[model samples]
Target: MIDSHAHLYYEKFDEDRDQVVLRAREAGVVRVINIGTDVATSEKSLELAKRYMGFYATVGLHPTTKVVDLLRDIALLETLAKANPDRVVGVGEIGLDYYWKDVAPAAQKESLAAQLDLARRLGLPVVYHCRDALEDLFAFLQQERIQPPGVFHCFSGGPSDAERALALGYHVSFAGNVTYPGAVNLQAALQVVPVEKLLLETDCPFLAPQPVRGKRNEPAHVGHTRDFIAKSKGIDPGELERITEATTVSLFGLS
Candidate 1:
């Protein structure tokens, strides 16, 4: 299985990062995409991608990060992607997040637009993170004409949101939160996501699945999410794994 999104470079895994990767391999997670939230973390992700065989990296600035000079940061992301075309798989973990009003909505929109433009210029896919700003995100995408060969990571939206994302040519990735007993909206969204556009992720060191909730998540725990999604969809777990794995590989251009 491919853990389509993870933050394996976070300090949470500092003590035993290698062991965590080993565990993921043992758990049948053949590939992991280490996502970036800012310049520093993006560089760290690149390093980890270089160090690990089945690991890939993405570069982007999270909406919540203070952007004193958005142009400079976007340029830095471009430089990184150009420098490591093989290792940098996409442009992502980038999108609107109104969950925390710390950053101005205008700035978040600006950063998202600039980054999307960068991805288009580079001929790379994207990994989006939308939280409490689905309406605004959809509006922006509609206005900008950004046809995504990308994904909506950790999707918690309703069926309409899933439909719109699918219409935009983006994959919908579910994470551990989908396993929560109370996640009715996610379940509804999952039902609308066709098998061809489905992807599974851990978003590790963050949203750990049930049976391991409240614990620091790792790539290995992706199996729990895969199993839950398969059960929710009433499909065989092995078949679900095969379909999602193929979708992930095709979306991210993984080897």
Candidate 2:
């Protein structure tokens, strides 16, 4: 199994980060792609990837924060990607996040389009973040027609939204939230999406699965989400693991 999205560089794992990595390995998760929202975290993720064998990182600007200088930030991010080609496998965890007010929708669109262009030019996949802005996201994607289609990380939508993502040629990643009792809509969406396009993530230290809900989520708990998904979809756990892992590897060009 692989955690397609994580924030291990976050301070939540500061005290026992190594232990967390060990726990993930012990739980059978072989690779983890630590996503970056900004420049500093991107660097931190690359550093984390260097210390861990099966870990990797990505560099891109997130829209949740203010875009102080878009061009300058993209240039730095591009430099990071070029300087560490092997470590930086993709470009993102980048996209619109209307849930926060720090960056307005216009800025979010601008930043997302820039990063999307970056991924296109680099010939790398993208990891998108969409919250309360799926319509705008779908619209932008429809117009942009990106190459090497990316993922919709932590997807939170209905079957229609899943259809939209599928139509956009993007993988739909599920986090622990899908195990929630109130996630019937998400469950329905999951049913429609083919297993080949399905990816799983922890998105920790947040959205722990139902079994560990309200606690700090970690990669070790990814299996819980995986198990729930497999059972929900009537797929063998082992089969689901193998297929999703291959999908992740193919999408990110992971070793």
Candidate 3:
């Protein structure tokens, strides 16, 4: 299975990074895509990819980072994208987050636009981080600023939203939140997403699946999410694994 979204290089896994990776491998997670939220973390992700065999990286400036200097962020991400073409697969964890509207949506829009442009120029898929503000997010996406296809990570929208994203040539990725008992809306949305455009992720050290909720998530826990998605889609776990693995590899252009 391909864990398309993970933050394995974060300090949360510093204590037992090796053990965590081993557990994930033993759990049958064949590859882990480590994502970056900034230039520093992007470099760290590249370094980790070099050190690990079944690991890859996605470099971009997360909107929440408040990187208003769009040009600088784009320049840095472009440099990294060129420096490690093989290691870097996507441009992401990038998008607007109005959850904290107190920070003004302008900055988020600026950063998202710049990064989307960078992704188009680099010809890399995107890993979007859309939290709340679905209408605004959809508006920007509809504006046609980006060309390459991508996925919306931790999708919290409804069925219509999922359809819209797919129409826009974006895949919908489910984090552990989909397994929560009260997430009826999310479950319904998941049902509408086509299997071909579906991907599984842990968003680790963050959204641990049920039974492991409130705990530090890891790539190994992606199996739980895979099980959840399979059950939701009325397909077997093995089939879910096969489809998601293929979709992830196709999205990242990984062999």
Candidate 4:
């Protein structure tokens, strides 16, 4: 399994970073995409990628950093991507996040458009972040005809939203949230998305799965999320692994 998105470079794992990664591998996670939220994090992700064989990186400016120049940040990201084409698998952890009050909808829309353009230019799929703005996100993606294909990381939307995203050629990634007790709605949506378009992620240093809820999450916990989904869908864990692994590799061009 590939932890499609995680933030290992974050200080939360500073105490035992190496052990964290080792645990992930021991849990059967083959690769992890350490996503960057800004220029500094992007650089950190690149540095980590250079050192770890089981890790990859994606460069982009997240929506929350609204005041930053989209073109400039993306230009910098492009330079980073060009510097190491083989290591940078996708252009993302980028998109709208209105749930965070710091970013306005207009800025989020503009940033999303620019980043989508960058992904298209790089010929890479995107790893999107949508929060409290599905309709706006859908409109912009449709307007731009965004078709590079990607996944909605930690998707918190309903069945209709999942359908729209899949229709737009995106895989829907489920995170620890699906294991939450009141997340029946999200689980319902997850059921609707075909296994081929389903991906698994931990979004680590964040959304911890059941039995570890509210605690800081890490890549090793991805298996718990997968197990929950497998049980929910009445399938075996190995089948879920095969399906999610294939979906991730196809989406990110992973070997």
Model 2: CA > 4 A from native: none
Candidate 1 lDDT over residue span 90-126, tens digit each = 9988999999998999999999989999999988899
The TM-scores, one per candidate, come to 0.98, 0.98, 0.97, 0.97
lDDT tens readout by residue for model 4, 66-102: 5466678888999999998888989888888988899
| RMSD each, Å | 0.9, 0.9, 1.2, 1.1
Q: Give the per-residue lDDT of model 2 (tens digit) for 1-255.
A: 999899999888999999999999999998999998898999999999899999999998887967689999989889988888888999998888888888889999999888988888788899998898899988888887545578999998899999999988889999999999999999998998899999989999999999999999999999999999999889999999999999999999998
Residue 143 error for model 2, in Å?
Answer: 0.6
Tens digit of per-residue lDDT, candidate 3, span 1-255: 988889988888999999998999999987989899988888888888888888899998887785656688679879988988899999988888877664468878878877888888889999999888888988888987446799999998999999889888889999999999999999999999988889999999898999799999999999999999999899999999998898888889896
Candidate 4, residue 119: how far the Cα is off, in Å: 0.5
Off by over 4 Å in 3: none
Model 2 vs. true fold: TM: 0.98
Task: At residue 42, give the lDDT of candidate 3.
Answer: 87
Query: Native-vs-model 1 lDDT?
Result: 0.91
Which candidate, 1 or 3, has the higher lDDT? 1
lDDT of 2 at 4: 88
Kindly give the stretch of ten consecutive residues in candidate 1 with the minimal lDDT sum.
140-149
Ranking by TM-score: 2, 1, 4, 3
Question: Pairs clashing in candidate 4?
Answer: none
